[model samples]
Target: MAHPALKNAWPIPRRIVQRTRGHGQGFITRLMSPADLGQALKPFVFLDIFDADRAMLQAVERSGGMPIHPHSGVATVTVITQGHARYDDPAIGAGEIAYGGVEWMRAGGGVWHGKEMTAGDVSRMQGFQLWLALPPELENGPAESRYIDAGDMPYAWPAHIIVGKYGDVRSPVPAPDGINYLLVTMRPGESWSYAPPAGHSVGWLALAKGMLDAGSTVSAGEMAIFENGEAPISLEATGSEDAVFVLGSAVPHPHPLHLGHYSVHTSAEALAAGERRIAELGQKLKEAGDRQTASGSVPVFR
Candidate 1:
């Protein structure tokens, strides 16, 4: 579930007027990528929703799956909604990310992590991993990571401000400016709305579970990119099951996206610099060799 954006042939971006049902790769679904959907929504780039049951979790544990990976020029945000996870970090120490919790890592200059959070004692693990394109200033700066629990997270009614300001609530994460990311849950027949801040013209959300209505039906596993507008995003849970989703808005990124295997930057030179740093870390990671904990899992590397 910690995979990067697929480096497949970049396709001509189809203007997503409203919604899209993205393809699935086993437990993870690729909702948007930097190549297509991301062209219209920058700063807010790639997105994936992962839903794995207990059985799948055990399988991964046995195989030591999801090998360590490198990234730069982007910050990865992982949020859990269904179950929990156990983190074994050398820098931050041990912790747990349960329902509504978040794991944020800014792969500024370069970073290599994937095994930091192993499967926990839960029946299912479900949530999202969003890759936010870093601005010029931070894309090649120092790396940072934060694992915050649900109780400590800032919350407003029906939503958790995952990485930005919401009304009087503001996220603790030092995310770049001009971005607002949120996780929302609504019970059956419940209603909610999101009023974007000025200049935050880019708006979108991927439904995690249950059904929703935003003037149109948005089923589970679907992503909807709202048309450019300043009006509030009116929403409601339509069916018996509760609705949960992650929504984001940002001031459109002004730079042209420069792509790499596990990095994204605003210029070719920046991308090259990030890749070089990743190569250097890959060697160090090799030299460090098998630093897996007694728990039989490896921690993140930078």
Candidate 2:
């Protein structure tokens, strides 16, 4: 009664949690936050889906630049799913982050950044900005960052391993093991299955375009968080257009989240140390006269 590919589906749907849209500073939708679904899907916390079309770009350009900010005790992963984005990081140099490309920054201990990325010349830009909570060890260690081109990332048909291993391929992203993040694209009327690795019970997906039918319908600008289980999940493209989305799964973060003004840590003491380090770094940069730069490149304040 179904296509040949559908017959071998490894995972059936369990449950689907719809996205709760929220306001963003310069984006269309902010899917998850620390209070929303972040607790349920720790290690993978915070997700913002933004559309960088002509109008959005123009608004950003007119508004000038974003201020330098600090983050700690977490790693931020940005993936460009449609069009491209430009970044000039002193640590990783200058490059374009197109589809499948990733910018991973672990704000362990503390660091100041956020003046490096901007919209490229493409007519439209769309992507996901995700934050992962660091483990206790890495959460208080030195900050690190990497800008990996799409070509360097592990490749698989219709799916790019953004965080963890897929099949025999492993992503170059230096992240904690057991977590899996994938960028998947499916053609119209196509069928696909994602068999998550063992112990990865937290599963979720956010679509950028077209429709994905996982028993429940998930359209663009929507995110679907699955129920708690280890069963494989099946996905089908139900729209005429191609389906573009990013899915992530992991064993829930073991530590309790200690929230800060702009950081997340495993404990209160860790948060205090992170905040103190950020303050010291900020002061040092201010005294060195290298805190702000008008160029496109951002100063990596260590």
Best by TM-score: 1
RMSD to the hidden true structure, all candidates: 9.1, 2.8
Model 1: per-residue Cα lDDT over 191-221, one tens digit each: 8778888888899989989999887888999
Model 1 misplaced stretches (Cα beyond 4 Å): 1-16
Tell me the TM-score of model 1.
0.93
Query: Which one wins on lDDT?
Result: 1
- For model 1, what is the alpha-carbon lDDT of residue 162? 92
User: Deviation in angstroms for 219 in model 1?
Assistant: 0.9
Model 1: lowest-lDDT 10 consecutive positions: 7-16
Which regions of candidate 2 deviate over 4 angstroms? 1-11, 290-295
